[model samples]
Target: MISIELIRKNPNIVRASLLKRGENLTILEDIIKKDEEYRSVLKKLENLRHERNVASKAVAELKAKGEKFSKEVKKVNKINDEIKKLEGVTKSIKEEINEKLLWIPNIVHEDVPEEEDKVIKEWGEIPKFKFEPKGHYEILSKLGADFERASKVSGARFSYISDKLVILEMALARFAIDFMVKKGFKVFMTPHMVRSKAMYGTGHFPRGIEEAYKIEKEDLVLIGTSEVSLASYHSGEILQNLPLRYSGFTPCYRTEAGAHGRDTKGMFRTHQFHKIEQFIFCREEESWKEHELLRENVEEFYKVLGLPYRVVIVNSKDMGNAASKQYDLEVWFPSQNVYREVVSCSNTLDYQARRLNIKYMEKGKKKYVHTLNSTLVAIERTITAIAENYQTEDGHIKVPPTLVPYTGFGEI
Candidate 1:
């Protein structure tokens, strides 16, 4: 949640940010009104309590003087009743104000390009086809991939990536982990099930709640991205460095409820997918620099796979609630003849850290940590891109040279 103090101090800034996001300005106006009303109620409640205390002292004095104190006692009792009623009202109003404040998005960074991102650089070249090529589904099925069986066993939007594809998945994951480790990140396998607090801490809950898979029995949620668990791993802890990098490999679960009927044909969208996620905690002053480092990591990973890709800085309107600035690395999909998003890197600044209470001591002073996250590899989408880009005109799938050793074979 954004700091209400900041909003109170500069509502115009908040209003302008909401406009950029195309959000309802009335929401901000309502928050301001509720905040004012809550403050007024709090003041009244405080005054009532002070009056009660004064009346109680007067009653005590009357009793000490051995004078009839019945009238004073009744007056003190009336004051106490008013204080109790006001306290209840004040508490309810404060809760309502806080609940409303949680839905607001973070302010967009000033330097984030307002226009659509232009391709600054390109890598590799698009492979030309000599014969008509088939999509991944057709190619994988002929090689004995049993997605139908997977759906029957686990329901729709599930798959059993058998044969060489399973090996390919592992190769991709291992390749990503090694890449991140070389960049000084401590690799971890994070827990798949996280508490509600962890989900909200990463700014996934309260905004994207409907898209998450909830475990109603344990009141835990299956994480949509490893970033959630990785970011929350240091929750409430204070660090000393400006940049602390961590990588996590985990199976992410999502309802994908809102994406109904879209990308439903292939692995482009799924309820569960394996991901190697990269997360960083840094001081506010160093967040933008770390953001570029994270983007470079993704770009390098794709380049090593020998795929032609481009990086685009996402505009403010397209950035989600948690991110102040974002960029996407899109790989060329020859089948679609367009670039498809494969990885996104975001600089959340202190938006997530402040809510999670993730902080650090910087130069002998305390401050909220700035959090950033990027995708190292989402296995399914990466596989989709690879399948489309590296498909043979005959019937084979060519594995990238970088992943051949990990797979123990060069091609499938």
Candidate 2:
């Protein structure tokens, strides 16, 4: 959530940033108007309380003097009633303002592009194949992808992989963890389910509620990414460190409510998948620097796997609610003859910190920390990429040499 103080102090700046995202500007107007009313009500409530205190004191003095104290007591009681009413009004207005604020997305950073089609960097060569390349689903069907059984057991958008395919998935996850650990990140296997507050703190709730799986009668929601748990780890705490880096590995679950029929063929779009996410908490001024480091880390991950990929700046209108700027790394798929997103790196800045109440003390002053998250690897998605790119002409799959050590085999 944007700070009320920022909205009050720099409405124009806020408006300009949101305008770039094509947001409805009316909410800004509504918030400003309601905030004024809320402040006015609070002032009235304060004055009423002061008046009640004075009247109550007068009543005490009158009783001590053995004089009539009924009038003073009545005045105090009447002021109390007014204060109670004004307090309700203030609470209502504050709730309204906060609701609007929560829905308002983070302002896009100036560096984010207006279009996502522009590739910032392209790496490796698009592989050449003599025979026609089949999609990952067809190729993996012979190898261990059993969507038919997965659907029978858990409905559509789920997959059951055994044999070498499952081994490949685990190897990918382990490789990603080791890669992130070398990048100054502490690895954690976070909880797969988290409270609603954790989702909201990461700016995933309200807007993204429909896309998440929730417990029927509990406050828990299945995490879409380990980013949610990682970001909320230090919620409401004041950190003494300048920068904290952590990587989380978890099996994520999502409803895929918005992606109904899209990418339904394979594990590309699934309800459950393992992911390793890189998260960082740092001082506000150091966030941009950390953002670049995150980008480098992601690029290196794909490079080591010998995957051809390109990085693009996600358009402001296309980015998630929390990210100020996002970079998506798209891996080249030989079968599709195009690139597909395999990694997304974003710098949310202090938007999440404010919501989670995560703060850091600097020279005795407390300030909200800036947060950033990037996907080291979405196991299944990367496996799909590898399956397509490293497929032999005869349909067998060749494992990336870098992952051979983890998988204990060169081919799957």
Q: lDDT per prediction?
A: 0.85, 0.91
Q: Taking the tens digit of each residue's C-alpha lDDT, what string does model 1 give over 212-236?
A: 9988789799998989998888888
Mark the regions of model 2 whose C-alpha exceeds 4 Å error after superposition. 60-66
TM-score of decoy 1: 0.92
Taking the tens digit of each residue's C-alpha lDDT, what string does model 2 give over 1-412?
A: 8889988999988898788887878999899999999988888888888888889889999999999998888888888888888888999999999989998899888887775546899999999988998899998888988989988898888888999888888888888888887888999998899999999999998899999999999999999999999999999999876799999999999888988789987889899998999999999999999999999999998999999999999998889899999999999998878999989899998999999999998878999999999998999988889999999988889999999999999998
TM-score of each model, paired residue for residue: 0.92, 0.96
Best-performing candidate as measured by TM-score:
2
What candidate 1 gets wrong by more than 4 Å, as runs, is: 49-77, 113-120, 362-365
Error of 1 at 130 (Å): 2.2
Where is the poorest 10-residue window by lDDT in model 2? 110-119
Error of 2 at 134 (Å): 1.8
Q: Which residue pairs collide, candidate 1?
A: none
